[model samples]
Target: MDTITTYLDSLFASLPDNDKTRQAKADMLANMRDYYRDLLREGKSEEAAIGAVISAFGSIDELRADLGMPAQATATTTQSDPTDAEEEADEDAITETELRSFWHMADQFATQIALGVLLCAVSIALPAYTGGGRWEGFGVIGMFLLAALAVGLFIWGGTVFSQQKKQLNDRPITASAKQLANKTTGEYTRQFAAGLIAGIMICIGSLIPPIISAYIPGFIIENAGGALFLAIAGLGSYLIIYVSINYSQLKRYAYATTAANSTAWYHDGTDDDAANYWEQPHKHHQNTRARQDIALFHQVYWPTVLIIYLLVSFLLHGWAYSWLIFIIGGVMQNIITAVIARRDYSE
Candidate 1:
């Protein structure tokens, strides 16, 4: 099958790439596959079946003549009629298979990242559970394990995105493909809205325990309430991320993959800034790397801060001052966001 595909590619290498020619190539490949299968069913050797299929196709010219496709034009095409040139450029456009693979990878990446965040947020509260004395050791171990998992997820998801972007950088997105991706997300809109609302409510409701504990004296719900706050916030973040996936920008990304290479795409002088959004391998990689850096900081910084805060507040009995660390961490996070934006994608 691979050999047949290679042969077909070589045969049509010089032909004008347009809808009719694409249809013809598809038909030819199908016919070749059917013939090869028939030969195999008739007890022909694999080599013989392949050789017969190749011989049956004859030359490229013969194939073109048979398919009623015009012969490859030798003359330089004028700029006045850009249709043929535009059609030709779409030969290396993104296919349905690649798009599906991207979406699948994206979904996996999102779930892993969200889970990582959840684990990080919950790790600090593990010591408060299953008794306090020696189980604190268990909490430390749990925090280490969860942090390890979160780092691993960050690396995996970042690598997945970077590699996918590399493979798809030089491809264009077709109108049909764009529409299909848009429709796919559009179908889930109502569900996403409901889920979004529910997640926010869950986050808001997490504070109920603390508020109730203020009124009813002896329950001792401080740790539980704090843990609930982190857990619910993390869950709400996961919900927002999972539902807010912007699949439509995939088309723009596909085009931007090779925007730096002038020969790679036809500019035709329209909306140049928008067309040059992330600028191919170099700048695209910078943005991707920037994101990885930001994620790493979040994965490491906040969790470590939370662990310190929990230890000081619970064990050392420094709840009054330890809460200040969060404010510092939040400010640092905002700094990271700003730095990445300026360095990678400013104006």
Candidate 2:
């Protein structure tokens, strides 16, 4: 009964915690307990009784609706077959740490993309507003202000990423699980075509300002430049949104084997059977090292780049060219990464 309660808790843990939700969960749990006990009195084994009780318990969506809660896509899914439903229920179980990791990734990408757009827009707007009396020196001040904000946001995002990694690593997944199947090549190809079409639409939408400017004259061209900056930012935001949506969709593909069935007790004794279920050799080591190296590079590289941009902008008073340093740094980082990967692969 304790194990069953724990399992139910895991299922609902991702939802928002509140009084009504809590009471609804408690009610459902009590009903399940009653059903479980009834099955036990019918002369069933403990395992079968528990399984039957769980199987009889319906989807949480209807319950959530009755509780006046919004529909949640992350809620436990259902299947027609009892066995498959049980398997899916077990697989979809996720810890709060795992959910936090997904949210962090989404938030980091969104923040970074917004910052990129803001920096680009300010770069355009500052120069356009500079020739006036009141704003003569404001360009430099505004640029520095935006740069500081960007740095703070970058640091916060980095911290979130670090916290997510630490939390996930500290609590390892020991559940003996069946690895979920990846999407087929055909599915990926279809998605790629759809994404490309979406990207084209985004580009077309972004070019609307320039298209409009072509019909107008004079000072409007400068306005068109600002529009272009916005368009670039929009494009970036679009890509991030696309990536995040895809990531969320992909999460459904991964299912974890429940702890209750991590290992088969009736398996024939063998040396190979003693190996840990989650263990992978070379690929695991390589992936871990890759993630660590990438994280380290981002932590060091961005802060160093931000510092250099600030120094150059303030000392040389070259706001126009100083931003190019970021582009150059990005290219260099890619080159260095490629070279290191090649060297590592060779060894």
lDDT of 2 at 293: 64
Off by over 4 Å in 1: 1-89, 128-134, 246-347
Cα lDDT of all candidates, in order? 0.58, 0.49
Please give the range of 10 consecutive residues that has the lowest summed lDDT in model 2. Answer: 274-283
Supply the TM-score for candidate 2: 0.39
What lDDT tens digits, residue by residue, belong to model 2 across residues 270-293? 223212211222222333444456
List model 1 lDDT by residue over 230-282, tens digit each. Answer: 66666765665554442323323332323222222233322232123213223
User: If scored against the real structure, what TM-score would every candidate get?
Assistant: 0.48, 0.39
TM-score attained by model 1: 0.48
